[model samples]
Target: MNSKLLARIKVDAYCDKHLFYGLTNLNDGFDDSRIKYFSEKDFEVVLERVKSLGIGIFGIEPWKNGHYYDCKVYESHTSDPTDATWYMTCFENFKKRGDNIVYAASYFIPKKLLSE
Candidate 1:
């Protein structure tokens, strides 16, 4: 898991959770003006900060590299999302239960993202 990829994932997860474009668009709890200052450099800083805070990041390299579980595949016969994946299930779950359903699914983010 590369740091850049982890940062990208973090951004994606944040957007998915908050329904926003970027930190600048976040307004759920914290002050958007304050949170909006998170630049790419801030991402790196936060990555380091999280490590120091004792959070461990974990993920399979193949998965992080865009592979999907066979049992979870529905898009294609292959391991790639284009071949088949759990995307539809995710969508349906979201539609039925909203964002809370996403929290029920597991996430595997790269540990390298936490490395200094």
Candidate 2:
């Protein structure tokens, strides 16, 4: 996507408390363990065709902190916690049954704003 298109999308997605990006891959009715792992070379050869499609491709990873079961949908269905795509990712199983819940909040602005 071009800068103009991306800018417009981000603006609309992040504009208000009642708005958010709804994205998910869970509940496919199949086991996620069946997902395969590929080497970098394997992926480069496989996905090379999509590079010319002029689309943005992203990957998901877990936040360092947090203790959810399997998936963490950043913003809830009704925007309970906060409104934003936030960061969607998986969580590892706790070492003990009584582990404490933790959270580290931060924002990632693409560019630094300059003073006028």
Candidate 3:
């Protein structure tokens, strides 16, 4: 990782917070509660990192309040809410990312993903 890049890299704007890449214990409560958000200086940097790793981001999930990302009105929902594991099934491929991320952004990136 470039020192200059690290210096400018804030937290990922998608997840509630920037989590150190790892297998976290997602409790049974609200999924949002298990998330921690982070700040970012350049979305490009984040995009490059994600693309390099070929990360597949499923769609965002609505919170307990029925509000979508950023607490927006729940006029509609992302993917099917029926299956507990069906959330984040829709893959969102970004051509480019912005410096600041907001709205429709409860995106969660696992620290590391491994295939069995």
Candidate 4:
């Protein structure tokens, strides 16, 4: 499969909601265990997609945030509420319970006035 297309698909799937970026527990911790990410080669591709179509970035002021922000993706295994290492690779058994959620962080544009 084309890597770019794959990356686009991942972003499209995750952006089902109005959020420009967020975390969710939809992908079962199995077959699709691949952590959807936007770094290295896929970073730019994913970012662009989100910027053009993503919502909730400015929460009704899209022009304020400059459309969207640079986003990073991460994944977790166990659904343990005690785990705070979301930045690190996760590998537990919450998949069986269908609780492995993914995480994402996007750097919002610094507070700035929109140039009309």
Candidate 5:
């Protein structure tokens, strides 16, 4: 099985000091908890490197504390509040008219429970 990491770039406007706001794979394998956030430039470099390894990378930007404008959200069978999944839907020049676009967003699947 191939390993995948779904990560999010930190957005200062959407962070709370009491919570972890650093870049990390919602799954395991990668966690940068020491830093509260990552600069866009640094995230870009990391994206390329992870992609080269055949691992997927997603950017996340949670808006209004409940919506993810760049990806799709999915729910799991577990009753646990933390059990959920999401897939990256990052797009550029979205729509044929080139009217919409979203950035710095990603999806989450608790504990890597889902598969490719």
Candidate 6:
């Protein structure tokens, strides 16, 4: 991801504090590792590196208060509120876009609080 994009994502994640913590807990330890691994500068460098590797990048932007986005990239609510599994299923559509490089933005939330 580019530094600008990464910063935007971090800002967005920070805005949704509860969801950010919930997502971090869901991913075990990856959330913290990701924060440490991707400094703003590193994100910019990775973007250039991936491009040089001939990989196309795809980003999934979360819709405020929405569970998922439509196949056309529009945000929508899932038919079943009880099953949040739709969140993962939505990725299947992106997977069909042909393999290059697929990085999901939701993967970046941090685990421990900053003071920790």
TM-scores vs. true structure, each candidate: 0.22, 0.21, 0.28, 0.23, 0.27, 0.26
Over the stretch 40-90, how does candidate 3's per-residue lDDT look in tens digits? 323333333444544423333322233333332112443422322222222
The C-alpha stretches of model 4 lying farther than 4 A from their native spots are: 1-34, 56-116
Give a tens-digit lDDT track for model 4, residues 13-83.
44544333443433244323443332222323333443543221211101111223223233223343222
Q: Report the Cα lDDT for residue 65, model 5.
A: 21
Of candidates 5 and 1, the better by TM-score: 5
Per-model tally of clashing residue pairs: 5, 0, 7, 0, 4, 0
What tens digits encode model 1's per-residue C-alpha lDDT throughout 1-116?
99767676674564344332332322233332223323333333433433343432221111111222212323333343321124433334334533211111122334443232
In order, what lDDT does every prediction score? 0.32, 0.28, 0.32, 0.31, 0.30, 0.35
Q: Write the per-residue lDDT of candidate 6 for residues 2-114, one digit (tens) a residue.
A: 97786756645542442223222222244343432232233334334333433222333322122232232213544432223343344455446543332334323232421
Please give the TM-score that candidate 3 achieves against the real structure: 0.28
Candidate order by decreasing TM-score:
3, 5, 6, 4, 1, 2
lDDT of 2: 0.28
lDDT of 3 at 44: 32
92 Cα displacement, candidate 4 (Å): 31
lDDT of 5 by residue, 10-112 (tens): 2222222212234432312133342222334433443343333333323343222223333322232233223212221232212232432222333222333
Worst 10 residues of 3 by lDDT: 86-95
What number of backbone clashes does candidate 4 have, counting pairs of residues 3 or more apart or in separate chains? 0
Error of 6 at 47 (Å): 22
* Candidate 1: clashing pairs of residues: 75-83, 75-84, 75-85, 76-83, 76-84
